[model samples]
Target chain A: GAGVSQSPRYKVAKRGQDVALRCDPISGHVSLFWYQQALGQGPEFLTYFQNEAQLDKSGLPSDRFFAERPEGSVSTLKIQRTQQEDSAVYLCASSPGGGTGDTQYFGPGTRLTVL
Target chain B: QQPVQSPQAVILREGEDAVINCSSSKALYSVHWYRQKHGEAPVFLMILLKGGEQKGHEKISASFNEKKQQSSLYLTASQLSYSGTYFCGTETDYKLSFGAGTTVTVRA
Candidate 1:
């Protein structure tokens, strides 16, 4: 792909519904990141992956949120028993380098609306 | 942790200059600059990793002062295309934190 790609541009889910957001990073990008952005706020970090290894997940708001990159390219962010607070845009980003400050190319985010 | 950014919002006439700042409470390993247009994904502008190193891309430039735990982005002779929210994200100790962005509007 030319750039990072995210699936299900917009999703509406009732309370307690489970939803999954998928991301396909640019070819050969070794680093991946997930973020959540609420209305009128900057994106907040959720988790990070270097290839298939998840290095940091401390930013995930709750244990109900889980992410995985099975083959080091396609990633999924799953929210179990969604709540109103989970209504936010989820962004996925990728980078060629795993080192400090390498530019992360972002994908068009998935807007998740939880009722 | 969130880095502190100054001037929550700014409006500028095209061709003018402006500066946005970011300061962290702890030591920083690197500082990143990104621009996000309304309804679009953010695009990386530059990264400042070495202490006292400065980098520029087009009319946008950024600097990092490691000793001060701060970084600044400078927009010289701004263009209408430069109108967007600017965010400063930092990396330190396995943590990557982004500041509350500075919203910038460049008018004709």
Candidate 2:
């Protein structure tokens, strides 16, 4: 089976421009999560979705960030007015069950560079 | 808050062993281990619940101590493939707080 995947492996954007990153979770996965990883640091939680409902978004850094899982499969993370500080790798993960304890499978990630 | 990992980095030789530890200040519901290489996504290694049961996968294993809010990852007879940054995620609720990460460099 295909694992979780993300599009636009690399993206370079000008500061203040808006950018969107896409993620395709494993088929039939009920839980999806997004994380942001800075260079030489651990990934920080961004948001999470259970099916079509986003269960949590507390990890989102600011109002400029938005995410959606419309059909409970594919998800997108959008950043408005990107800043140089927003330049980092965005990772998506999914698990078979909705439980938080479930093991999550990760995607290759999309590296966003804001200039 | 994020957990703390000991020994920011370690260098080892094939067939040697090493231990990576993770400690959290808050009560944890679960602890997850992941290994990530440069320019790649993190790969899940194992998960240990609050029960403190020790689990193993191949030559790698882990122990979770609920009482101490700490976990230890053991790499026995380490392989070159084990060379990567290891992160421990502590789950107090639905979200996981990951540590700074411990880099393991294994030489042949």
Candidate 3:
């Protein structure tokens, strides 16, 4: 079976430009999460979804960030205005159950570089 | 808040053993472990719930101490494949806060 996957693998955006990153979680996973990893640091949580419901967005750093998991499958994280500080690896993960304690399988992240 | 991991990094030879520890100040519902190599996503290692249960995967095992709000990961007889960064995610509710990470280097 295919594991979770993210698109573009890498993205370079100019400051002030808007960028959208995509994530495809493993088949039948009901819970999906987004995280940001700065260089030499641990991943920081961003948002979470269960099916089509955006259950938690407290981890989102700012209002400029938005995420949607319509139809309970594919998910997208959109940044309205890219900033130099936004440069980091965007990781997506999914688990078999709705609980956050479930073992999460991760995707090869989309590394975003803001120039 | 993110959990605190000890000994920011470690170096070991094949067949050696190492221990990585994670502790949180607040009560924890669960603790999750992950290992990641450079330029790759974090791979799940295991999970320990609040009951202080211990679990193992291959030669890697972990124990959760509910009262102390701490967890320890034991890597026995290390392999080259074990060289990577290990992160512990402390969960209080619906989301997890991860630690700074501990890097492990194994030589054969």
Candidate 4:
């Protein structure tokens, strides 16, 4: 695709259930980031991937959140034992390798609602 | 910590101008501006990396002040298409912190 693409545009799961979200970044781009945005709040960094390596994940809220980019192209974020507080929009963004001067393109994001 | 954006919401008519402000409590190395429409992800508008440089995307522009730890986005001749939420992300200490956002409504 021409831009970052995210799967499961919307998801609703009962509390304690597990859910997985996927993202396909732009081809050849070397940087990928995951963010979580709660209602009426700014997007908070969750994790960052440089190719197949998960470089930074200091922003992950807890141990229940995990993300992986095995091939460096497609990535998945998994949440275990979902809680009502986990409801939020999960956004995926990608930028070319380099630095802050580069532009990061974002996907529509997945709106997850844990019931 | 994240930055703070003023004027949580603004309403304007076509050809009007609007200004949105973002302030941080810490020194900044760069500031990034993005606009997000309803139900869509954010799109980059511009970036100000220096203390005195200004950037423009068409009639939309932004300015940064490294000393004051603040940045402002300017919109000239506002168009209906400009109605959306604007977010300012500040880069400092190797991390990017974003403001809550400012929503602008441009009417015909």
On lDDT, the candidate that comes out on top is 2
Model 3, residue B21: what's the lDDT? 98
Off by over 4 Å in 3: none
Quantify all predictions' global Cα lDDT against the true fold: 0.90, 0.96, 0.94, 0.90
Compose the digit string of candidate 3's lDDT tens values, residues A39-85. Answer: 98999999999999999999899999999999999999999899999
Scored by lDDT, model 1 comes in at: 0.90
Question: Highest TM-score, which number?
Answer: 2
Q: State the lDDT of candidate 4 residue by residue for B64-89, as single tens digits.
A: 98889899999999999999999998
Query: After best superposition, candidate 1 residue A111: deviation in angstroms?
Result: 0.9
Q: How much is the lDDT of residue A9 in candidate 3?
A: 98
Measured against the true chain A, the candidates' chain A TM-scores are: 0.98, 0.99, 0.98, 0.96
**By descending DockQ, how would the candidates be arranged?**
2, 3, 1, 4
Q: Tell me which residue pairs clash in candidate 2.
A: none
Provide the clash count, candidate 3: 0
- TM-score order of candidates, best first? 2, 3, 1, 4
The candidate with the higher DockQ, 1 or 4, is 1
What lDDT tens digits, residue by residue, belong to model 3 across residues B1-108?
889998799999999999999999989989999999999999999999889899999999999998999999999999999999999999877588899999999999
Q: Write the per-residue lDDT of candidate 2 for residues B1-108, one digit (tens) a residue.
A: 999999899999999999999999999999999999999999999999989899999999999999999999999999999999999999876688999999999999
Residue A77 in model 2: lDDT: 99
Residue B12's lDDT in candidate 3: 99
Considering only chain B, report the TM-score of each candidate against the true chain B. Answer: 0.96, 0.99, 0.98, 0.96
Candidate 1 chain B has its poorest 10 consecutive residues by lDDT at: B91-100
Docking class of 4: medium
Q: Which ten contiguous residues of candidate 4 chain A have the minimum total lDDT?
A: A96-105
